[model samples]
Target: MRHTVERAMAAERSRYRRFWVAEHHAVPGIASGSPPVLLAALGARTSTIRIGSGGVMLPHHQPLVVAEQFLMLEALFPGRVDLGLGRSPAFTAPVRRAMRQEEDPPDRFADDLTELRDYLDGTGAVTAHPVSDRTVPMFVLATGQGLAVAARLGLPAVLGGPLLESPDLAAALAGYRRDFRPSPRAQRPVVTIALDITVADTDEQARALVLPEAWAMARSRVTGEFPPLEPVAAIVDRPWTDQTRRRVEATVRHAVAGTPRTVRRRVEELTERTGAGELLVTTSTYDRAALAASDTALARIIGG
Candidate 1:
């Protein structure tokens, strides 16, 4: 995980301003379950790339804990840290119980987010240690009600890759921007769409690169177990159920995978349609090198 992030930083240093890691618990297919630890390490290694959580699942943790961790991260890296919060429930019932004995009530997210921000800014009844007045810019991993909450808080919204493919995407983003209420953190709304794309020398190669993770996503929904990604060669040889095949194809279709030229055009259309200021590329192919190469191709085409 460290090596993969470092390679990305090295290759994208001039092309991108920030690097973010995600949090997933008890998923074998994912390695980043602790964003604070990972981001701190990344912050220590690189001087310029802004390191942050793509977001921390707020429901599983206390607001004070979240504030202290990111405050320390901002202190270590100073002006190059961000705190993106999320509201995803635990994966399974048992996991949910382990994280929160009483399931998180959806209505509490606003209060939770506000308290976290206060703790970071030293406006809470108590203050965070390693004292610094600088506020770490906060963002929301927008999904479900997250977009509206972000707007109300006047924080930037990070729309997920799946949301980018939704039919209502343009309208939804417009609404978020329109309804946004200005706050001390931000006076205007900002939108950043996260997208899944793979750029290879040929369309076939790019399609092949996306198969492993897409197939894994389908298998998880069909079987209730999100398994680790498999090589495309191994996946193609295996037999599939009619149901599984349909599900797998549906997931893969959400992605834009093709030669660099095709990917560039598609991404430009998406940006124009959404009016998003930033595009967060999330290319997840099984092979690390293939994923890195996809990023390289994209950087060459549009990174400048």
Candidate 2:
């Protein structure tokens, strides 16, 4: 895992762009503690690449503690930390109950988000020393009503969905632009779209690589089975029929899984549709060589 992260960091540096880390702590069979450790290590290794969580599931941690941990990270890395917060519990009911018996109500997310900002700014009723007055950017990961809250606060937001055909994505971005209240940190709305990408040498290979991850995600959505990612061979051997592919494609159309030329054409279409200023790419393969090849292909696509 450490080596994979190091290679990713190296790739990011070579590409001269920022990359955010995706944390899947609750994903069964994966090492849970690797994300934070990997982020810190990447921060130390790279001189200019910005390091951040694609999002941290905020409901899983106390806001104050989260503020402190992120503050420390920002203090060490200074100018390169981003805190992307998500409201999902990121686990099953039993796991959530075990973690916090008296978890705060979900309705309190807006208030908690405000308080977290205050704590980070050192203006909360209880002061935090090192984090006060620091200028690390905070981004909210929003899919629905959370988008409205982020806009009201004038913070940048990241959304996961299809850019071209998603009415929800259009509505959320419009709401943010319309209702945004200018803060000292941001005078204008900032929107980022997270897209699932799996690039390979050919369309067939890319789709083959994506099927296992897509299948696992689909199965997990229905059943709670969180298994380690399997190879394309395993997915091809599964009983999923063409009907299943059509069903999954309805929800997974946002994913860009094909050759670099094909993926780039889709990405260009998405950019025109969303007017998003940034793109976050997420891949699900386990092999470092495959991951690097995909990222390299993406870089060429974007740069062209």
Candidate 3:
């Protein structure tokens, strides 16, 4: 895992335009997880790449702590840091209970987010000592009604989930643009859509890689068992009865996986459909080489 991270860091230094590290816990056997160390290391190595949690689940941490941590990161990297905040716990109840503290309600997120803005701007009661008055770009990672909140605040939003499951991308973007209120920082809505993408030399190869993720996700949905990446061959070799295949297909349908050509076409179609300023790509896989290859393929497709 360390080697994979090192290679990814090296690759980011070479040519990647933007990179995001996802934050999650309860992956099979891992415990006491924290992404700050990994993110800090990546920040130190890369000169210009934009890095942040695909989202740091806001409901799990104190706003002040989050603000301070991200403020420190922005101080270290300046101008290249982003803070993407989301509301989901990113784990099941047991894990949440284990991690829960006395101040876990996080009900102050909306108010706290406002306060964080003030602190970062150097106008709040308390300020980050080392990085006082430093402002960094903040994005709210939203689904459903959270879009309205982002739109009203004129904050950029990263929309997740498939178009089929939620408000269509076109409608959501249109709504945000229509209802957007101008803030001092942004006069218009900045929209970024998140999509699951997997690419390989051939469509079949890409599909094969995605099958394990699909199967795992299906199992999670049914039993709430979040496990580490199992071998793709293992998933393929196991008998997926018709009922299981149907369940897995429902989840997989939202993802875009295929050869480079197919990925390019789908991404282009999404761009045309939503007019999104950016598209955030998320891939689920255990192979670092394949992950890097997938990112390269996406860059080519997006003409980055």
Best by TM-score: 1
The sequence of per-residue lDDT tens digits that candidate 2 reaches over residues 37-99 is: 667877887878788877777766667877887888888888878888877764566666765
In the range 1-304, model 3's lDDT, one tens digit per residue, is 4653665575574566666776677777332255566678778777878777767776677667777888888888888777777776656777777767333563555776677667666677877645644467778887756777777767888887854245576677778889988886577888888888998999878877777678887777667776666788788788777877897787667688998888888888876777778888777776767877787777777774
Tell me which residue pairs clash in candidate 3: none
For model 3, what is the C-alpha lDDT against the true structure?
0.73
Q: List the residue pairs that clash in candidate 1.
A: none
Residues 1-304, model 1: lDDT tens digits: 7675566477546466778888988778888889999887787778877888888989888899999998898888899998888888877777677776475465678899999989988988788877787879999999747888988889999897667777877777877988899988888998888888898999889888989988998887766667888889999999999987887787667788999788988888988988888877788877878887787788787764
**RMSD over all Cα atoms, model 1:** 1.7
- Measured against the true structure, the TM-scores of the candidates, in listed sequence, are 0.94, 0.89, 0.89
lDDT of each: 0.83, 0.74, 0.73
lDDT of 2: 0.74
